[model samples]
Target: MTLELTPILTRLQNMLQGFLTAIPNILIGLIVFLLFVFISNLVRNAVHAIAERAGQPRGIALVFGRIASWAVLTLGLLVSLTIIIPTLTAASLFGALGVSGVAIGFAFKDIFQNLLAGLLILITRPFRIGDQIVSGNHEGTVEDIQVRATMLRTYDNRLVVIPNSELYTNRVVVNTALDKRRLSVNIGIGYGDDIAHAKEVILRELAQIDTVLKDPAPQVLVKELGDFSVNLDVRFWIDPPIRREANEAQDRVLETLKKALPAEGIDLPFPTQQVLFHDQTEETDGHRTRQREGWPSRGIERDPRPLREIRPNSEEVDNRS
Candidate 1:
């Protein structure tokens, strides 16, 4: 029995010795991987800084940095793997990846789609970080563009994460795409006021606004003769055309127009409705129709009180009847 146990013990000792022999190599590989991680991080930050200084968009810089970092880290991981397992070569690793890529792609189809879209966005430059945009139901400033999603900071201060695939495939409205934006305000004046004078006052008031663009020249045209007033559309252009600025310009214009129009004897009209009594229900017995004012003559009584104070004479009532 002792002799039989000696062979089994020898096999166990051999396996333990092999594991101990690989321990140092495994430790060295882990150290090398840690060094690669540190280097990759440094390179990522450096690339980001360089790209930003070069006047590229933040999203573009981020993409460049992330790609660089991931590439370096991937290389390091492969090298570490080779060190840990001497028999596994880089070619074999990549070959195995190629073989399994189809299954991995299927499992992460949406992720790949967004990654591709993110790359396209960084290249095409539709809208940049900090630009206000509207896509589908989302309207907000672009916070950041990521590997698989785009982040938005809404006006109400909520963060939204949207898949890049949607943004690339759908329409996006960039409000700040142009240096100047056109704005229009409708003003209604009483029909009795002078149309020409009202227009002149509006244009002159618009000229006083500092934010308004003068090159295009503000216009005040009669949109229509409304029910209670003459509707005039006061269209103008504003510079540095952000939503906030445009809104401020509009407020100033409205306040000035209101005061200016009134001072010029142009009354801002209120909604008014006119009623006509046609007297369609009139008593006509093959003769002239009843007149409204004299339907009951002035001599007739319109008293509606109950007669309880005086008793009428029976004979007088009989004679009048």
Candidate 2:
């Protein structure tokens, strides 16, 4: 029993002495790491200020600062680890990490993809904060763009978080990409209304609106002839192409046109259909030239009587024959 206990006591004594001997190194490493953390924060602030001064966007500046801070922190961590273990060099540490990084990358593939996509988006400047965009089923003002997701504030005041990967891969429409955007409205007038007069009236009314742009000039084109009326497309340009401004401009244009067109004797006609009834016994039956409703007159003319009047006359003619 004494012999067996002796080895256990000896191993415990060795461990204690080793721990005491390494205490100073441990303290030194801790102090160095803490100092490096403080220095990294200072570096982050300096980089942020410099980027902003260089005219970078706020998000781009922030990301650059964060990258610098992380690099500093990573270097400090390696130095601290080397201090704690004299045998561990930065090269050896990196070599070990290289093997593990593949597993980590697979484990967090989506996270890293979003991070890469976000970085590209910031660099490309496809859309900026406060810009209105439509992506998939989500459309709103971009409030903030983060490494993993983009924050959107919908027109109805709802918040939506979309993954950056999705935004980068899918098609996104930036409504405010240009300084001015064109808006079109279709208005139909009766066939009898003068096309030239209607176009003049629409263009004149559009010119009066303040939101509409004057340089490109407004246009009213005859689109197509419909069953009841002719469709005229009214197209104009507006500045500061935002949703609210566009809607307001459209509302004003519609109101002005609705009132101005009818007041000027231009008729806004609804769908009208003339239905005809025919009797097989009538003399005009199967005669394309004589039919008043189906076909146009081709030098042959006939008075169209009521179905009751034509039916009895046709039957009497048939009896006589």
Candidate 3:
């Protein structure tokens, strides 16, 4: 029993001696790590302040500061670990970290992709906060842009969180990108109404609206001859291209047209159709010019016979029976 216990006791004593001898180094490593932590915080704050002063967006500044702080902290950690364990060489530490990094990258591939995509979006700035945009099947006002996702508050006041990778890869339509946006309203007048006079009235009325921009000038074009009326397309520009403003301008334009066009003797006609019934077995069935309802009047063709003068032939009667 004594011989067996001797080796265990000897190993314990050596471990205790080694620990006691390394106390000073451990203390020094801890102090260095704390000092690095302090310096990293200072670096983070400094980077954030500098970025803000350079007119960077708040979110972008925050991202930059976080990256700087993490880098400093990682370096500090590596240094402290080496100091605490003299056997840990720089090459060994780097090799371990490289393998660990690969594993971590594989584990969180989507997260890293979103981070990179978010960084790119902030740098490129396709759309800013408060801009109304349409992406994929979602459309809303951008509330915030974060490191992983973009927040949107929809027109109906619903919140949406979209990954930055999707925004970067997919198509996005920025509705309010321009200073002024054009809007069109289609109005139809009766075929008998004078097209030129109707156009003049519409243009004059549109110019009177306060929201309409006067620089580009409103346009009135004859769109097409509709079933019951002649369609006219009225187009005009409005400033501060927003959904609310666009809606209000459209409402005002429509109201003005509805009220002013009729006061100027322009007619807004309703859809109307005339359908006629005739017997196919009549003498005028195949006579183009003599057809009562569908054919034009011709000098060589006689008028169609009255309904009282026509009757169904024997074949049609027998079939019906």
Count the clashes in each prediction: 0, 0, 0
Cα RMSD for predicted model 3? 5.8
lDDT of 1 at 179: 79
Model 3 stretches astray by more than 4 angstroms: 1-45, 69-94, 279-283, 286-305, 310-321
Model 2 per-residue lDDT tens digits across residues 13-82: 9999989988898899999999989999999899989999999998888777888888999998889899
The lDDT-based order of candidates, best leading, equals 2, 3, 1
Candidate 3 lowest-lDDT run of ten = 311-320
Return whichever of 1 and 3 wins on lDDT: 3
Leading candidate by lDDT: 2
After superposition, the stretches of candidate 2 with alpha carbons farther than 4 Å from their true spots are 1-40, 73-93, 279-305, 313-321
What do the candidate models score in CA lDDT, each in turn? 0.84, 0.88, 0.87
Candidate 3 local distance difference test against the native: 0.87
Q: Which scores higher on lDDT, 1 or 2?
A: 2
Kindly list the per-residue Cα lDDT of model 1 for residues 3-90, writing each as its tens digit.
5788899999999998899998899999999999999999999999999899988889999999999999999999999999989998
> On TM-score, who's better, 1 or 2?
2
RMSD in Å for all candidates: 8.3, 4.9, 5.8
State every prediction's TM-score relative to the real structure: 0.76, 0.78, 0.74
